[model samples]
Target: MALLMPASLLMVSATTSADAADAPQNTTNARQAKAKGKAKLVAMPQIVQQGKKPASAGSAKAALTATIKPAKAGRPVALQVQKGKKWKTVSKTKLTKKGLAEFGAPISKGGKALTYRVTAAPYKGAKAVTSKPTTTERWLTASFSDDFTGSTLSPSWSNRGIYYEPDSLRECSKGDPSAVSVSGGTVKLSVIKDPTRANERCVAKKDGKSTGSFDYRLNGHIGTEGSVSMRYGFAAARIKTHKLRGQHGGFWMRPTTAGGGDPRAEIDVVEYFGDKHPQGGLTSFIYSTKNNKAVKTGSWIKSPTSFLKNKKDGWSKNYHVFSVEWTPKMYVFRIDGKETYRTKVGVSDQFQFPILSLLSSDYEISQMPGGDKKLPQTMNVDWVRLWQA
Candidate 1:
């Protein structure tokens, strides 16, 4: 499993203090009486920064603080700072009514970054009034976990389907495509077109030659079905495609059916095939089903549609982090933590519930331009993960 680790080692404490203007007082009964009626009111505290660091590259903090007067009597007015995107509680029971309130939690630094706002209400009010968001600090990287970076096959992967044949899309062949291999540190699978190979399987040659006459399309695809099934979490992969040849590569999820009879749903976290479209560049779809392949519904997929170029460089010889977040009712696409695509569903289609597997395709190469001429094309998967809610 590939995991991310904090590159730096530094711990900073969160604290707050009262902001007051201390002026010399007049020593007179009449003056004191007038002063008693006019006491200084403190402004609500604002978060100078979201965290001690930045959430992701190009990410910034959304900060807010409420200015309020000191509460009368002993009834304390407690303040709290909570997260909006993740909905995680950050700081609570703060007594400061002015100056700054620190919420050092990690937030999206760029592309509609997460924010903090001051919420004020009477201690006895039914609801509090929140202030508008004020951007402040930068989001920094957190610790990493080993989600996908290993060789040992776990029970999470079934390896049950017919081995995919290299260069072909046919099924039930002598060389089935399902027999994908991961030895040393690399994961390998065949993308074949012929369905008659053994176990429907085929292999790519290191010398850039076809191993079989079937032209089968066989490649390895693994998931976290039995190992992990998180309700709400994040999954990402850092990958680079084989040069020149165009192939489909992505990180996606599908719901597991109950007793293998429930409706299935698929969330195409991110699918990149070189086909260019007028709206953008890539084409993708978000699909759902009532029963496993029983009734399939789909929506036009978007995001990562535009490509990033460095002067004249293209999408090759580079590694990008393709990530997505699955909530209870929605899914979000992110490139290095910046959100690009966000979709919501009113009803739980029950389609996108399973832990997703990392997948690559060299199949149907004949359908692609110069696919037959291209002797060798490969997709490399860096990692896969599920963040538990």
Candidate 2:
């Protein structure tokens, strides 16, 4: 219409046009502000359980995990512990690419129950958020513990496979007391050339067929067979593995009574095949009887390098605690208090005892050509502790 509007009407019409022109920008700004505020609302950090319920105090360590809203990665998260009436920040870590943060809850001595929480710090345009408090189960004293401060292996331990000789699996290796020793507050387990068979060369075999030749070796194999056994508990060892590829270092458990109508099970808490090996060489598995036939569960730990402290920290380079939390429902495997794997299959309810060994098997000796030159590959155990459930 060509007719001009009144002054007052013109002003109103102009204001309407201006408001319409600003609507999209204003709405966008509101959305941005709302999103920034919402980003502060992080999900409560959850305790990663070693069993059906939240991890108890008896575990080597507790893991707390949480996610940030709006997928903010690389943000800092702090773990806090409640003491008396105050909360103390104990540890801090940055979030991963997927907006995840996992904190290893610091445990105190004497097995006392503790409360914990996590907090995300204010960053960029987002505000801070704190998780709700969670209390851990009562810390239980270890039922069995060995610091290896003595000059001899504890009476609680007995040599394993001492009389065993070259077998199909271990073509040229056997257990010998000489391969295990206690001193310097640690137990040293070694794969060494058998003294009596130092000059002997053993033919390595695979599937009962000769594959190659290697020197005779003795392993540090010991167990708490009749001395210590538990139905369900947490078993842990502070150990540093051997650095070579020819041998295996194991912290495992087997039923105290085997080969009857009992539930037969083998819990391999942790196994290492030395450094730089393909497939990472770290595994946690269970072998159990199903329908009167053997069934295996678990596998090589995935992304094993993620368990290490740094690029220079190999499994053999530094001492780490390898542990298993055995419950009637499942088995949770951990390295240095960080869970590596868990499974519900092949859970053992029978009384099982712990075993430690550094062994050479024929099937793997071939991978370490001329490996005998690196004889006496030793694994060190700082201590072993068990908390029975």
Candidate 3:
């Protein structure tokens, strides 16, 4: 099971300081949380999206989360709302390990609409960030999890395939609709010889393949881009892979803008090439541009097996839970809900989406032990789940 290690390493540290000016500071509408200062807010009143649930009784499913920019470690924040030009505090909580906060119904259901915002008072060396007013009943529609239960792909997913640029990002692979399929309560991603474009020329060139080389392969890739993009949340997937060479399977994320810059960059949650890889088969990474140079972190998690349930339950043989906690200042990666790697290098500050793929590159073709004989290897995902930070 496995994935992305760029050709060259960026010379930046993962725990470097990040500035508020580095992220998108725009506030959106009534459907989502509106921030006036430096914090990102989202409120979910139910486990699943509903018109509005009774707030008076209190709910275990109801939740409120905030992501603050220029994060202050362990800072206390007041969640408030304006009433007759007066912003009254509803409740207070301190930030988590990554400058994030989550609380249940700050104001118990009162049968009245309350517009809420988070207030982070100025602290030692940390400037204040005040959020805009957004109502409890009118919060962003919380996204539900996809368990891959049906025989077809869910509408939440879009086929993002046919990798044209033969750069390090895509290698020499293309996305074919047929390459991705859902069955038996699981999603399957495969890499197979392209029967349709067997002799068709490729569009881009890697060192090993040029435009004149015939199109020979297709990969399975599906992502949530236009249809639905999640902001900060915990994304987890239970996956099992094959120990094949020449390709890798991965789960990653990116903002809707698709640009390579600070706070709106790529998040490689997990990538596994195969079993017993030189770098130990699993890696987590982040990518963005800082100081006109790329900023990257997260690597082959040094103790991947420490989180495994047992020796027989390795990645290629069984499904394991891989998750990432996205707070304001950094990302914390984990397997089976236990921590693995944490970094502040490139954290996306806005709406981003999830992706799944099994890709190959012409540069790695020589590593396949069975060559084309092992053409249709696959990655099986038991389910995909998400919850706000």
Candidate 4:
């Protein structure tokens, strides 16, 4: 067991940046299984946090993550849960460089908790091994993700303008719940013409700056305002945009609306202007309007011709994982695992909830081709995941 201490240490510490650095070294065994040995299970925690509370009996996307000793880097691992009378393999994934395995399956959403364990296949001379059973924690876990599987948005979200706040963070638009829908396993936020409000009205200062009179646009937007906010985490979304230029789609975070919180900054994860324009139509921006004028950084991801899985795909035609790895010191914006931008100058240190919006700010209205003919453009989000530190 003495040989297992280091691996146990990693499980105890949950592989943070400080210790993850040593993970690679632990896997470089000279014998690579040529050395004779029985597969021995190392001591590890027996519980995994899925959400703040145990999932209801029918919940899906609840994940259980595990790590194994002998570091099975890049090797397939079987995740099983004890069923009726025997263990059943529910999912599988390769161990990461740090010997981590993460997989999730629908749990007893509202029933009693479920137990899960991981099994590693034999390699070299080492025999197969399984971790001790770990039970799912009841509702009240941390970290959350939504795969947009159900037909409706999770209760965690607020349709924003419907009851509390008004449309678009900038107020350049209004939100119409009808514009938001979930279909084909993705949440769609479409910028459809609000014919009811098209000639309705516009107040002074559509912030007062564009060529067109503020013709109203209804958008699809949702926020986590009163539900959840975290000071730092990796928040990401996989999305595909529409092919029109009039409205732009975005993923961003806003501070909780509680009175008397810091208004220091807003984290803009990713924003895509409709199809084809300069700078590849993708922008990662950070903004602060605390003292009246705006202070911002980040820009369009340049030369993105090869950023896609292939040249035939574009931001609007394909799904891209856009995320921000937010740490206390910096915010790293990435697209499809490629770094698009990074900056420490305006990273928000306070809790901020996430936002998904498709807006046609009066300021950028002229950029849309064929005008209203392109109405009903959408932003499809497959899922949103958050991992807090």
Top model number, TM-score: 2
Instruction: Give candidate 4 regions above 4 Å deviation.
Output: 1-142, 161-172, 198-210, 213-215, 289-294
lDDT of 2 by residue, 50-69 (tens): 22111223444554455554
> How well does model 1 score by local distance difference test?
0.39
lDDT of each: 0.39, 0.71, 0.65, 0.64
Reference-based TM-score of each model = 0.48, 0.77, 0.60, 0.60
lDDT of 3: 0.65
Expressed as tens digits, the lDDT of each residue in 163-239 for candidate 3 is 55455545557788888888876789998878876766444344644533334678888898877666665666667
- Clashes per model (N, Cα, C within 3 A): 88, 0, 13, 20
- The digit string of per-residue lDDT tens for model 4 on 71-126 reads 65776788777776799998887876666565655444355556566777765434
Native-referenced Cα lDDT, model 2: 0.71
> Model 3 off-target regions past 4 Å?
1-142, 168-171, 199-215, 258-264
Against the true structure, what is every candidate's RMSD?
14.9, 14.9, 14.7, 10.0
Task: Give the worst 10-residue stretch by lDDT in candidate 1.
Answer: 38-47
**Residue ranges of candidate 2 with Cα displaced over 4 Å:** 1-76, 95-100, 109-113, 120-130, 165-168, 258-263
Q: Which stretches of candidate 1 lie over 4 Å from their true place?
A: 1-155, 158-160, 163-214, 242-247, 258-261, 275-284, 290-315, 346-364, 373-375
* Ten contiguous residues minimizing lDDT sum, candidate 4: 41-50
Global Cα lDDT for candidate 4:
0.64
